[model samples]
Target: MRIYKVGGAVRDRLLGKPVTDIDWVVVGATTEEMLAKGFRPVGADFPVFLHPNSGEEYALARTERKSGRGYGGFTFHASPEVTLEEDLIRRDLTINAMAEDDQQNLTDPYHGQRDLEARLLRHVSPAFAEDPLRVLRVARFAARYAALGFTVAPETLELMRQLSESGELEALTPERSWKEISRALMENQPQVFIEVLRACGALKVLMPEVDALFGVPQPPAHHPEIDTGVHTLSVLQQAALHKQPLTVRWACLLHDLGKGLTPEQEWPQHIAHEFKGLKLIKAVNERFKAPRDCQELAMLVGEYHTHGHRALELKPSTLLELLQSFDVYRRPQRFEEFIAACEMDARGREGLEQRSYPQADYLRGAATAARTIAVQPLLEKGFKGPELGEAIKRERLKALKAYKENA
Candidate 1:
């Protein structure tokens, strides 16, 4: 059996990028042979094993055939007869199809190295169109390597567009699609993922809520970008520029979903879009089965982002209510995430990227001021039960009022 370092490890190494994980492909190896050699079998559908010592994944060189539809509708064949080149060709992209042997020699059966040199994202073979998930995977790769000037090959994009039109995207499970989306959000240029998906019409099938924002108009005075979709992409870019976490980036993307639903008569002024957006956010969360933290933060940013923008104008009680709504005392980190998301929203407009968002500090200080309010003082005044809770609220509200005044 010959083992070779394959896929991302080889690709990233040649690109001068950090290699986080190294996947291995064992050619001419059987499950019995692997098990005899102390390799632990882990793959349920294919012959994937873990090294006895390193515990790293080592999958057998295998080929896949389109069995049905969607991403998971594939039949994999792994045997001593399957060639390494066959395994490589079944990969999603050319850059990911390359491999490195133990002797430090590179395998370029599909010209992956040449495409990498050309700064292009090309499919390994025509079989790429068989898997709908490749469309998302290619978009994600585009997002990850966008800073390196990589562009999708025109032919590859046409394949993605064809896949989009084939209705195969509808067969994707929410969990699988969300896996790609969430990973893409953390990439170097997450907005490029969205743009690439849109270019191939995958966004409309995967995220119709986000797609609807494309041609929707917004007030040019506040959003010089004018298009709600463009503004959302800007916000995602700002989130990445600031190195914000996944929760913040996701909130920024979904924060403006309501704007897309604004009645044409309402035009650029979405007076209560915040409330309207909560429904859209809920739909996305439920559809994607998003994590509780991501869903909760997206919902909060969607429903209260305007309140965040208007922090300086809100009354003391309103500020206290907002803090309590975030449950800052129990979950202070989430509050920071909320503020970061809102700040990205404020600075995402054209020519406003460098603009300061003092509302973040204002609200942060309000939370701090409220946190400093002592419940002991109310207890010392003989307050009990619900009365004590009410008194504590009053004191916190009074403190926030003072804090607002001082600011």
Candidate 2:
């Protein structure tokens, strides 16, 4: 049996990028031989074995045939007879189809190295359309390599458009789709992922709520970008630029979903978009099965991000209510994430990208001020039981009022 380091490891190495994971494809290897070598089988539908010592995966060189729909609807043939060329051609992108042998020999059967040099994400063959997951995968690669000037080949994008139109995207499980989306959000340029999906029509199928935001108008004075969709993408870019966490990025992307539902008569003014956005956020959160933290932050940002923007102007009672709503005392980290998402929203506008968002520090100080209100003073005054809870609330409100005035 001959093994070659394949896929991303080879692709990244060729691009002068850091390789984090390495995969091996074994040629002229049978399942029995792998089992005899003490390699444990892990693949359910194909011959994939973990090395006896290193625990690294080594999948048998195999070719796939389209037999069904979605990511799992495929038949695999792996045997001693399957050629490395046959296996490589079944890959999603040309850059990912190259392999490296043990002797350091390079195999570029499908001209993957050529596409890599050209800075293009080209599909290896027409078979790419057979798998709907390739659309997200290609978009993610675009997100990863966008800094290096990599873009999806027009022909490959056409195939993605075909997959989007084929209803195959609907066949993908929510868990699988969310995995791709969440990973893309953390990439170097997450907004490119959204743009690519939208360009290829996949965004409409996968995330209609986000898709609807693109053409909708917004007040140019508040959002210099003017388009709600563009603003949403800008927010995502800001989140990535600041190296924000997944929860903050997810919240930034979703904070403006309500603006897409604004009536044409309303044009640029969404007086209560925050309230309207909560329903869409709930549907999106439920649909993707986003983590509890992500869902809660997205909803909170959607419903109260305007309050975040107007922190300096809000009354002390409103500020205290906002802090209480976030449960900042119990879950301070989530509150910090909320603040980051709001700052992204504020700075996402055109020409205001570098604008300062002092509201974050102001709100943080308010939380600290409220938390510092000593319970000892209230207890010393004989405040106890349910009355103590009310007394603490009174103290926090008074402290917040003082903090607001002092600021």
Error of 2 at 120 (Å): 0.7
lDDT of each: 0.93, 0.93
Tens-place lDDT digits, model 2, residues 1-407: 99999999999898888989999999998999999999999999998999999999999999999898899999999999999999999999989998889887999899999998899999999999999999999999999999999999999999999999999999998899899999999998999999999999999988899999988988888888899999999999999999999999999989989988899998888879999989999998888899998999999999999999999999999999999999988899988999999999998999999999999999999999999988898899999999999999989999999998899
- As for candidate 2, its clashing pairs are 213-229
59-113 per-residue lDDT for model 1 (tens digits): 9999888899788898999999999899999998989998899886999899999
Once superposed on the true structure, which residue ranges of model 2 sit more than 4 Å away at CA?
none
Model 1's lDDT to the true fold? 0.93
TM-score for each candidate, following the candidate numbering? 0.98, 0.98
**Consecutive 10-residue window with the lowest summed lDDT within model 1:** 372-381
- Candidate 2, overall lDDT? 0.93
TM-score of 1: 0.98
